[model samples]
Target: MAIDELLDEHEQSERVREWLRRNGSALILGIALGLAAIGGWQWWQRHQANQQSQAAGDYQAAVDAIQANDKSAAGKVQALPEGIFRTLAQLELAKSQVKASQNEAAIGTLRAIRTSDQALTAIVNERLARVLIDAKQADAALKLVATGDSLATLEVRGDAQLALGQREQARDSYNKALLKAEVGTPQRRLLELKLTEAGGTPPKTESQS
Candidate 1:
């Protein structure tokens, strides 16, 4: 090689070595941090999987306890960490309480359910409203269902209206609910009965109209 070319090569090599000497620690730290992050993420995923499994097992145990008529079933359900399973368990507990003529307790349990899930919220509200109505707190039932437009909520609102002697409001609520309930379903059948009780005629089907 020419002397100038060799000198340029040597200069380039020295510059690279100097740069490495300056940045070697930072590069190594960056790689270490990257590896640590990966390891932490893997550990988190495993921990989450384990927690989900435990929650599932606890929920199943609660269900079994409830089915066996164990008095401690509610406590078992209540012990579940908050999640979908806990919310469902609370629903089951509320159902059992309502069946056992524990309307007040059922209301309390239903009210305690906290979730960001829209569907679960509707279900909880419907159940809570029904329990409130059964407890002769129709006003509270109506208030609980006031902002909800789901089929279940509307039906329960109608029941609450009927309880409050607001036949016209009950008829309107049931009519709105009937619009959403599918034909030939038990829900539609129940709405029809409720409509009749409120002296409201079912709207004509499309074919009839």
Candidate 2:
């Protein structure tokens, strides 16, 4: 090889060595981070599986008890003390009460769900609010879906607030309900109708807030 070409090749090799010297710790750190992330994900998946298994068992027991027409027995499952287990118990109790035509007791069970599983809080509150409305407990339902409550969806919030005569607040919540794309097709159409009923325009079609 020519002397100049040899010198250039040596220079390139030195530069590569220098880069490795400076960034070796960073490279090792990146590998460690990747390994830790994978480990954490696996650990989380296992924990979630265990939780779901336990909750499922409790829910099944409740269902069996209900099928036997034993209302009190349906509520006596060995609960996992948290998560969907507790929510399942409340839901079963509510179902039993509703079956017996005890609207008051059903509302009480659903209301208990509002503070049980926080991740499922929005759904529970919405269902409970509907039960409350059906039972003519609009005032209590309104309290559960106040201006800043985190335990309800926008659509249900709007409906509950409207039932309690909070027109303006209900309008805002309907607008929000229109924004979430997760509510599709017939539900969206219904929400649009509700918005009009509340004297507001649907989202992206008008400037009403």
Candidate 3:
């Protein structure tokens, strides 16, 4: 409508264009960085999934080897990355080793499964103590079972104590095992016999009533 008004509007449009030109590179760079971050996160997720899949396959192979009585299962398990699957594979390998009478190798395999899980550690310790007792390393077996709270570990500790001629300690350990074991189980009966052999009276059973 007026020349002055049109001139003012033109100046404002040029100023806006000038501002966009000055900051356009920064805007583009910000968009590029955001896209790169998203892409990197996706890549990491895929990488983790692949790693987990590979670990699972390796663990399953180790399990099959153990079931088939293949001695190389232990080496296959040892090659897996540290995780729950790896721990289980190692346990299977140790079981096979023990069955095959490779006590020294089994001990080493069981010892390497030290995880942060207290329950898992207890299980490993129980197996290791049993092997040590069979190997006639009574002192080592006793030490391994010192913190053990399971019935099996307690019985093994009693056996170790008996081997070392500590009848009183053996009696105490057997009694503890009897308390933890079920009333009528064969394990309870065996613990009772062990207690009697250690010069302690067998605990009263439900059948004694």
By lDDT, the best candidate is: 1
lDDT of 3 by residue, 1-209 (tens): 79999999999999989988999899899999999999999999999999999989989998998899876777788888888898888888888888889999888998889588888888888888888888888899889888766788889889999989999999999998888998888888889989998899996766896
Better of 2 and 3 by TM-score: 3
Which digits, one per residue and each the tens of the lDDT, describe model 2 over residues 73-163?
5345434355566677777777777878888877767765634445567666667777788887778777666644332467777887788
* Per-residue lDDT of candidate 1, residues 90-203 (tens digit): 998889889989898898899989999988898898899899998999999899898778888899999999999999999999999999999878889889999999999987
Using alpha carbons, what is the TM-score of model 2? Answer: 0.57
Full candidate order by lDDT, most accurate first: 1, 3, 2
List the global CA lDDT of all models. 0.92, 0.73, 0.88
The C-alpha stretches of model 1 lying farther than 4 A from their native spots are 206-209
Stretches of candidate 2 exceeding 4 Å from the true structure: 1-58, 67-69, 77-83, 95-101, 113-117, 147-152, 182-184, 203-209
Q: What TM-score does model 3 achieve against the real structure? A: 0.80
Worst 10 residues of 1 by lDDT: 200-209
- Report clashes for each candidate as comma-separated counts: 0, 0, 0
